[model samples]
Structure formats: C-alpha cells, structure tokens
Target: MRKNLRVAAYAICVRDGHILLARSPADDGTPEWVLPGGGMEHGEHPHDTVVREVEEETGYRIEVTALLGVDSSRRTFPGRLLRRPADHHGVRLLYEGRIIGGDLRNEVNGSTDMAAWQDLDALAGLRRIRLVDAGLRLWRERPAEGRVQR
Candidate 1:
C-alpha cells in the first residue's frame, strides 16, 4: 500500500451563536462544508498556517488565540495500482481564532467556493467535513494534552 501524510491547521470561530464555515468545492459535485483551513506550507509554523489559510479560504484576517487541540485520522482509498489501496493519514491542528479585520468574501478559484457564518444549532443538518466536528470538539472539551485520539 502507498502512504500519504498531511499536516494541516484549522480554526473555530464562533460569534453570536453562529460559526464561520467555508464551502469546499468538490469535484464529485457534492457540497461539503468545512472549517477555514488547509495543509501547512513547508517550514511554516502551525499558528501562521491557521492565520494564512483562514484568510485565503474565508477572506477574514484571523488572530489565533488558543491552541484548541490536534486531531488525527487515517483512511484507506484506491491506489494508483489496480486493486491496491493507499493509506492516508491527516494530522490537523485546531485553534481558536478571532476575526481581527478584513471584509467577508469568497475565495476565488480556490479550494472553497463560498464562506459564511452558519447557525451552530443547524450544523447537524448540513453536509460537512469531519474537520468541523473535530474542531468543535476540541473547542468544547479542551483536552489537557491538546490532542484528540482517533
């Protein structure tokens, strides 16, 4: 099996009972909502990655305040070789962020199509990526180790 590893950062920004979210543009034509974040550039600090990614995806300048936690997950998917599978692992750092400035706008020709603040209570009914739930859990529980086991 082939192996792939991804290290990323994400932010949880909530205000007035609403949570900030970005709509990931899926090639499969399925709508997927996710927190504003993505893979970190090489040699970039996780804190810096969260701030940069949030701005790129949501068009909001964010100030990362707290390290919420890290979440890790692994999955297997079809590989390049016929009938073979690839192992994919993702390590995501979740952080508490506050919008410091910048007007709201959608990312242009990027991974996400739109950005909006959604009602937190209504999130359960929306089609979202797992990172949303993971980020929220870290925000809510705030484990001492700053890591969520999967």
Candidate 2:
C-alpha cells in the first residue's frame, strides 16, 4: 500500500459559552463544523501553523496559550483507476488559543467557507468532524501525557 502523511495544527478556542469553528467540505463533500486551523506549510512550526490557519479560516489573530495535546489517526483509501490502495496517517496538534484581534469573517478561496462561534451547549446537535470532538477532549481534559484516551 502507498503511504501518505499529513501533519496539521488546530486550535481550541472557547469563550463564554461558545467555541470558535469553521465550516469545511468533508471528504464526502458535505459541510461540517471543524476547528479553526489546518495543515502546516512546509518548514512551518506547528505553533506558527495554528496562528496562520486561525487567521486564514476565521479572520482572527490568535495567540496559542498552551500545547493541549496530539491526536493521531490512520485510514486507508481503496485503490482507484488501477492505483494502489493508500494509507493516510494524520498527526494533529491541538492548542489552546486566545483571540487577540481581527473581526469575524469567512475564509475566501480557502479550505473553509464559513467561520462562526457556536454555542457549546448545542455542539452535540451539529454535524461536525471527529477532530472537533477530539480537540474538545484535549482542551478540557488537559491530560498530563498530552494524549487523549480512545
């Protein structure tokens, strides 16, 4: 099987009773709620990646307050068009971020199409990516080993 890897950073920014979120098209082309960050650029630190991604997807300048934890996942894609099946491994860095500046706005010509502050109480009702759930666990639990329980 072919192997692929993606290392990304994401922020868990909560305020009052809301959490910052972005709307992105999922693998199936349906929009889902996700954290306000994304994949790292080549040679970029995970810290810098979170800051840059937050601004790009949410129109907010954020300062990462803490390194929350890391979430790792692996999935395999079926072969297509005579190509070999591929294994995709994703390494996600989760950070606690505080918004420092910028207005709320949707990303244009970017990974995400909308940005919003969603009520935490209603989060369970929203169709969201698994990363959102994993990020929240990392943020709230703050495990000493910097890993979330499966």
User: TM-score of each candidate?
Assistant: 0.92, 0.96
Query: Which candidate tops lDDT?
Result: 2
- lDDT, candidate 1, equals 0.90
Highest-scoring model, TM-score: 2
Tens digit per residue, CA lDDT, model 2, 1-150: 999999999999999989999999988999999998888889999999999999999989998999999999999999999999999999999999999999999999999999999999999999999989999998888999899877
RMSD of each predicted structure? 1.9, 1.0
* Residue-by-residue lDDT tens digits, candidate 1, 67-95: 99888899998765475687989999999
Query: In model 2, which residue pairs have backbone atoms overlapping below 3 Å?
Result: none
User: Whole-model lDDT for model 2 versus the true structure?
Assistant: 0.95
**lDDT for 127 (candidate 1):** 93
lDDT of 1 at 28: 76
